[model samples]
Target: MSYSLQKKLVIVSFLFVPVALLLLFLLYPSLRLLQFSLTNWNGISKSFNYVGLDNYVSAFQNPDIWKALSNNFLYFGIHALFIPLEVMVAVLLNNKLRTSNFFRSIVFLPYILNGVAVAYLFSYMYNPINGPINALLETLGLESWIQNWLSDKGIVNYSLIVVSLWRFSGLHVILFLAGLQSIPNDLYEAATIDGAGSWKKFIHITMPGISRVMEIVLFLNVRGALQVFDIPFLMTQGGPGLASTTFTVYTIQTAFKYNNYGLASSLAIILMLMIIIFSYFQGKLFKGKGE
Candidate 1:
């Protein structure tokens, strides 16, 4: 073979290896997970039974499962709101302002910290008796507002959502800032010359320009919110009677705590399907492809 042909063959071989390995490492396991979702296998047995749709039926019937699902809706309802909040923050930072970098780093710092550490840190701060949060409430003469942050089923999910907003707002802020930079300053100047108010300018100029970033961040928030586990795991442990058990946490509990890999696999399959559906619709929304 000539040298160019040999080089082409070598390059193809290099790419082929990773593609084959990716199928092995990623695709094969996902296929197995789908298969396991239909089984009666306990994950340690030599023998197995085909449960078919029974696992999924049970998952749908379980109230713990429903609570987890509903809480996901509520969690994501709040999670979705962060996009605008981050955009607002980023726009402010993007303006000609002193100390923009300082504030940006301060906000982004939490994203680098461990999720579990953030969860546990909040857990300590939310402690009812001795924590500063409650103490500060009492000091401000709003002692009535002080309640068990993690133990109160009514408030635990909300508390977890607040912690989530703090943890991830920085990330979305950075994404929005990147989006903001991609907008031409001349457009804003033109909008101002056209007598556009801030809100009008945002609607016609800022929002349209940032649609791509909004799509990116919206997708990230949806996926991240669906897979949210660490905060509720460490802070509440799906606690106050499963008030905040997200899909991921329930999957972990089902697999390890109950040793029911079949059920866990069922949950995993459903979670995957739900997220895929969400992503599909979100993509359509961003592309203006579907209603």
Candidate 2:
């Protein structure tokens, strides 16, 4: 074979397995889910009727689903608020302090833990009667601050958000730290020599350097907030009369508990589209600001 043909063969050989796996695992399942969304199929039924956009319309009109979606937004908003704080924490830890490595490990430990385990652990901590959180409030003589973390309708969602923050804040910090470390030290040294203050250096040097990682982290926050399931599901079961029901939890319950697989599939598709839309706009916003 000619050299060009041999090169082509090698490229194809390397690409083939990954392409095949992507089609089999990701693309195929997504297409199947899309098809199911247009049907009136109960999950176990061998037969289903095509329902067109009815399922989607129904999903849009459902008040409960919308409430769940609002809860998702709460998750997104609260987490987004913390992104800057996480980055600052990452910056502080990235400094050449004596205990930086130990602190980084401590911060990252929660992210490495199993999600289900974390949810269960928090569930116990939030238990109304014997929970450590409440007990601590009592010990501090701040008994009025203690409330049913997982049961009260008004405060249940906030309680769940706290658990989410504890579980994922470490991850955000670590990502920011990685991004911060990748930046060349010469830039900071040069800035200092030119008499740039710490705030100026951070604004011009650190923020621009870590913008890509920040974009990714923001997209992750959006996706994660929308898809939150374990904490609310395992802890409250989206309880307190659906006060803490997130979009993903509602979707699952719609399918299994209500046996409305078609609607569930539609809800899932809506969620996927929402993530895509948010990501697209976010990318555009970042690109515009960068320019």
Candidate 3:
């Protein structure tokens, strides 16, 4: 073999292991989940029969699934607030103020903490009787504001959303911060020279510069919102009713709590499809705008 052929062969040899592992671990299980969605596998049973599209039909007809899906939408809506909030923080921090580094670290700290730990901490904070939230409310003579944060069906979803925001908003801030840093300083200087104010400069220059990073942030937000499981699972366990139950939480309950693995697999598949469809449309929308 020539030198170029030998080098290419070596590179291919290095790539083979990771590629095989990806297929074996990620792709194989995904395919298996798709296969199981069509069956009545009780998770422990060695033998199962194919049931065609029955599970998918049942999932659609199930009221609980609808409730969980609505909650997913609510979760998505609440999580969407983080994008603007994080972008604002990122922009403010990009001004290169003296305390910017300190504030950035403070903002980014929660994203690195363990999900379970964060959930537990927030659970304690939301406790009704002695939790700091209630205590502070009473201390400020706003006793009426204190309620069972996790138990009230009306506000439990919102309460959990607060926890989600506290944990993940920092990561988005960091992402936006990086995007802001990558923007050429000359663009901002030129805008300044044109007598453009801060708001106008942000609108005409900064927004366009960080558009790609915003796409990534939006995608992550959507995916995280749809797949929200850990915080709700650890904190509320899908709650005092189905009020806080997300699609993922419902899927877990279906599989393990109810011993309906086939149905759970079906739910998982549906979620996968939703994410894929949303992502595809988002890509198309961004591409159209770019063109």
- Please count the clashing residue pairs in each candidate, in the order shown: 0, 0, 0
Clashing pairs in 2: none
| Residue-by-residue lDDT tens digits, candidate 3, 154-266 | 99999999998898889989998998899888988998898999999888888877887888878887888889999889999998888899999999999999888899999
In model 1, where do residues sit more than 4 Å from their true spots?
288-291
Q: Compare candidates 1 and 2 on TM-score and give the better one.
A: 2
What is the model-wide C-alpha lDDT for candidate 3?
A: 0.90
lDDT of each: 0.87, 0.94, 0.90
Best by lDDT: 2
Candidate 2 C-alpha error for residue 155, in Å: 0.7
Look at candidate 1 and tell me the lDDT of residue 38: 90
lDDT tens digits by residue: candidate 2, 7-120:
999999999999999999999999999999999999998999999999999999999999999999999999999999999999999999999999999999988899899999
Tens-digit lDDT string for candidate 1 (49-167): 88998999999999888888788788778878667778889999998889999999999998999998898899889999899899999999998899998899888899999999898
